[model samples]
Target: MNRCLSGLVGILFVSISLVSCQTDEEIKRQRYITEGILIFKNNCANCHQDKGQGVASLYPPIAGSDYLRDKKSVICLIRYGQQGKIVVNGKVYNRPMPAQPQLSDLEVAELITYMYNEWGGETKLTNVKDVTPILNACKK
Candidate 1:
């Protein structure tokens, strides 16, 4: 009976250890994603839609978008906005995307992380350390 109890405790310990084994980066990524979801819902979902499927021909879809291929441009546009016509998945959208001047560098990074993970077929985090320089360079 004592041996069985010890075995059960050992199994419980291993299970807990495994659950707690996520790296610090993984934890940060999850936090960024959560914040990003809130930001997207509050700021972007109106045009981009909740699932990023976009709104008909008026807005362009972010999911599986060819525009994502130019990540640097995407980052710049998110903060500075876009004017004139743009093409996504062979569809041309002429509407201008307003700039999100209120979003900080960290917030932009989080938003990108969420967008890429959820729709851009990415499984990694977009760290703010990497975003700040790009944002600084894009300042007009």
Candidate 2:
């Protein structure tokens, strides 16, 4: 009976350990989303709206935007805010988006991740490594 109980306890421990161990993909996805939400709420929600739909033609709608779906362009825009006229969903938004250079690459990646996942996009995860180059390239 003692041996049986010990075996059962060991199995329970293993199960708990496995449950606690999140895969890299899962961890990345969670990190990406959580960071993204915080950054978005703080930096973007005012102009882009809480849902990323933007406020009329004043700002561009980020939610369900074809522009956001293009990872390269999106990264560029995030790293260095676009100047002059830009169009989203056939609407022209001429306002300049101020550069958020204060944020780290990791934070920017997280913000992008949150925007992609929350706003009718696919499950592709954006990591710091992927974002760093784009951020560096933006300066040149």
TM per prediction? 0.93, 0.82
Tens-place lDDT per residue, model 1, 1-140, is 69999999999999999879988999999999999999999999999999999999999999889999888899999999999999899999999999999999999999999999998888899999999999999997
Write candidate 2's Cα lDDT for 65-138 as tens digits: 87775787787777678899887888788989987777889988888888888885567688889899887876
- Model number with the top TM-score: 1
Which segments of model 1 are wrong by more than 4 Å?
1-8
- Best prediction by lDDT: 1
TM-score of 2: 0.82
Q: Clash number for every model? A: 0, 0
Query: Once all C-alphas are superposed, what RMSD does model 1 give against the true structure?
Result: 1.5
